[model samples]
Target: MDYIAENTNFKLKNSAVTLGKFDGLHLGHQLLLEQVISLKKQGYTAVMFSFSYHPGNLFSKKEFELIYTEEEKLAKLRNTKMDVLVSYPFTKETSNMEPEDFIKDVLIGKLDAKIIVVGQDFRFGHKRRGDVKLLQSLAETYGYRVIACEKRKYKDSIISSSEIRKELKEGNMETVNEMLGQPYSILGEVRHGRKLGRTLGLPTTNIIPVSGKLLPPCGVYASKTIVDGISYPGVTNIGFKPTVGAEKVKGVETYIFDFNQDLYGKFIEVELYTYERPELKFNSIEELKQKMQEDIAFTRNYFLKLNEGNNSSYSN
Candidate 1:
């Protein structure tokens, strides 16, 4: 995938484009991308137009914590087979452009877009003054096509990155994973820790999450970690280790089962599968160790059941 800046003065012949924040690339965004990919197969170049920052963040006083940080968002987009990724920084002047000018300059003049795929409720231009109807209205004059994707659903609620963020903060891992079509994962480099787990017989590699990335509730979880192209069963703790002391600096410490090679400085991806228990401050170090043993046991059983189900399916 080729990444281009927004202000780049370049023109293409024909392209199929999708526009969105694509924060987490949730099911809804995936549906739109699939359409772009299909259009590319039909001979148009696939392009994705996204803002480096959320448009809403431009006017809001409160800082927005992204579901996936900007780097993570780009990483996910690179995995797709899109021809071009145009990322532009949002600015006051850009936001104040008229709907018509945006169409003529951005859609037609810059990208030479032949087709645009957007959600039914998609909006653009100054103060979100543009909608799908406006796009359709200008389609013929601009010589482009507009495709509106219907809302995607998981269970009763429509799937969205905002809803997923709220659920993750509330520790609803099961639903988060269901709507995401995969486990809720965090990617970070393994950092040096207090080595407290080693003393307790459950060694763990500490993780320092990317700044401004939203994290799940502080607790222990039945999780798995992927390292160097291999997946391993693991247990993770996300929070300030209350039992160790009163320091509240948040960190993710994961103990990989059946593996003990040093991992400091190596990056790892931890997938939270199930919530085991909340962060507890035990009265004694012995008590903490006992509870940690229970967490490991639960993690092991969870993977065992998962593997058993896999075997059962293959046998059938």
Candidate 2:
């Protein structure tokens, strides 16, 4: 797949494009992506057009944190059938573009869009005036087809990135994963730590999450660490090590089961499955060790049950 970002000289032709922030790329966003990808059979290039910055950040003092960073988003979409991914640079001037100009200059002019896909409530352009209706209205003039998808819901509530982030902040991994259509994962390069886990004979791989990346409540979680594409069950802690000595930046430290090969400087994805407990400051190192052991056991049981369920379903 091709990635276009920070540069505007590249061009795509005969593209089926889906436009959105695509922050979490949840089920609702996936529907729009599916629509664009489906047009590939007709020989149109599947393109995902998103902005470099979250639109909310431009208007609000409370900066919007992303469920997936640009790199992480690329990693997630890299495995998909997408032909092109464009991260349009967002600026005041870009935001001020008139709705029709956006349609003309970006869509029809630059992308050569043959088909456009978006959600029913999708909006864009200055003062957020554009909508699916506007796109459909210009379809005839632009010579492109407009396809709007209905919102996806879970238990009658709309599935969205904001909702997923809310659940994540509350450490509701199960609900977040369900809404995401996959595990909520942190992808980063292994960083050097104080080796506190090593001192306890329970070594772990540590990673510092990128700035503006949303993380769950500082706590221990049942997780899976993907090393070289193979997933290993793990007990992960997402926080500063308060018991040993609190760090300035947050980190993701995971103890992968049955594996201890050197992983320093290697990039890995740690997927959270279930929340276990909050980060605590133990009175002594022994107390911390005991709690960590318990967390590891819980993780083992969690994956064991998951495997059993998968096996049962396969048999059925």
**Structural similarity to truth (TM-score) of each candidate:** 0.91, 0.96
* Backbone clashes, candidate 2: 0
lDDT of 1 by residue, 38-112 (tens): 987789999999887787688897777788777666766777888888887788888899888988998888889
- Candidate 2 residue 106 Cα shift, in angstroms, is 0.5
Candidate 1 whole-model C-alpha lDDT, 0 to 1: 0.84
RMSD of 1: 2.8
lDDT of 2 by residue, 231-306 (tens): 8888999998988879999999999888988999999999998999999999999999999999988988888887
- Model 1 alpha-carbon drift over 4 Å, by segment: 5-13, 309-316
Worst 10 residues of 1 by lDDT: 307-316
- Candidate 1: count of backbone clashes, pairs at least 3 residues apart or interchain: 0
Clashing pairs in 1: none
